[model samples]
Target: MKKNTYLLPILRTAYESLTKSEKRIADCISADVTTFIGMGIAEIADRTDSSEITVNRFCKKLGFAGLQALKLALASVPSEEVISEEGFAKEDSYQHIAEKIFQNIQNGLADTLSLLDYDAVEEAVEALLAARRIVVFGVGNSATICQDFETRFLRFGSIVEAYSDVHQQATVASLLSAEDVVVAISHSGATREVLDTTAIGKAAGATVISITSRMGSPLAKLSDIVLIGMGREVRYRSEATASRLVHMAIIDILYTGIALRRKDYAANIAKMRTVIRVRKQ
Candidate 1:
């Protein structure tokens, strides 16, 4: 749904009235607009740390028949980006498509910004900074995202395990310690393999960070850190386009944030590599 729509305005107003904890719920709603728009109030409360009373108050404050009415209102608008038979990534009209990409990119970034628990991000980064290994887990598209994550972390001199196979992921997750961290990516938050891997990671006393689309998903509940994508952008079916891109964009931002935080050390490491390059030459 576009920002200019009916539900968006009331939700924004109600959002301003939220307390710290209530704001958490609001953040999740903004992160995955479609999911929240369709979800039950109890689910929202469970994810956001709000009680039934507060949830009702929050809904009333938004001028709904409590929560279901709110959901129906949100559901009224088409959730996907109705592109004119052209996907956002096509290069045929480079400039026009570039602008659209910027829009989606900005929306994805907004989804991250609105929902990101900065403290959690910091905690996850701290773990990575101090860890002996930064293992990554996910299934399907998330595995591709994990591979990209492993690539980025390796650039910072961190050891990485990027596992696409469930058995392989479980095997490595089994070996992690409290000094290690697993960054798990799952769009649905219900991926059995990723859930299993993260469960193993948790049981092994390792920190877990979940990147997923739904805040109330099982993966989020299990994770120490949750990074959500509010990409109800693909309205119609169970397609994997917009939301996945949103997840990767968050990863990119996180990767950039980590790299910038360690920029000086990374630069020094690069400078040291120059001597080795020259010697080889």
Candidate 2:
């Protein structure tokens, strides 16, 4: 994680959609973030030729709580040389491309870890543990993550299912009860099918846990527990590509937490090991 790592990527990602005033602020900060970091909200507004309210709005648009949160993020950034591995180039060597991909994943993981709420994660774990049935909803790349979740939790003898088909997801969601849990994964947090299905699950009295990058997105709004991730896009990679690993890491955390809390966890693992040994022959 370099200085302004997440900040710079965020500015780039949100630049086009920003209002004129917000763009001015983004430009000022992008031009010289170090100087901007030293300024207060009023000072920033003055520097960008915008109002204090606009400055605050800009910060929130970029996913921070306010200008103060943005400032803290900037202040925390350590000054370092921007490496070419941050972006890809036709002239880059194979090793360089690999390094760039690895760097992006590392930065994304670090960003998500920084924003993770342990209490929310624990809450999600508890929901899964108590769930009579765990149904995961996802689409596209997210569907793969849903499958991963099912594969991991099913080993513990949990009644888990991952649904990628929109129709099936909606059907299952409609039938769920308070004893069920729905784990929804979406990078943008605004996928229509995911939101729709999750809403059904929510309406059915099931616990809804959302893993998403956008906290203010509709999916997050529908969720009972929200786990936010910082998944900035790389040059050629979509935001989903960057977010996939972060989501998987969160799943891993939840899986381990639930596994550890289970009284029969050791016995389950021992039985699984014996089964594997017998199957190998």
Superposed by TM-score, candidate 1 places the C-alpha of residue 273 at a distance from the truth, in angstroms, of: 7.7
Best by TM-score: 2
How does each model score on lDDT?
0.71, 0.82
Deviation of model 1 at 254, angstroms: 2.7
Q: Put down candidate 2 lDDT per residue, 1-281, tens digits, no spaces.
A: 22244566556435655789999998898678788988888888887889999998988877788887888777665566232225667899999878777777787777676667688998999999999999999999999999999999987889999999999999999999999999999987889999999999999999999998765677877899988775555667664576798899999999999988999988988988899999899
Per-residue lDDT tens digits for candidate 1, residues 153-242, read 676766887899988888998988998888899877888888988999999999888888765578877998877664534333355455
Query: Which residue pairs in model 2 clash with each other?
Result: none
Q: Give residue 140's lDDT in candidate 1 (0 to 100).
A: 77
* Candidate 2 least-lDDT 10 residues: 77-86
How displaced is residue 142 in candidate 2, in Å? 0.6
* Residue 278 shift from truth in candidate 1, angstroms: 9.7
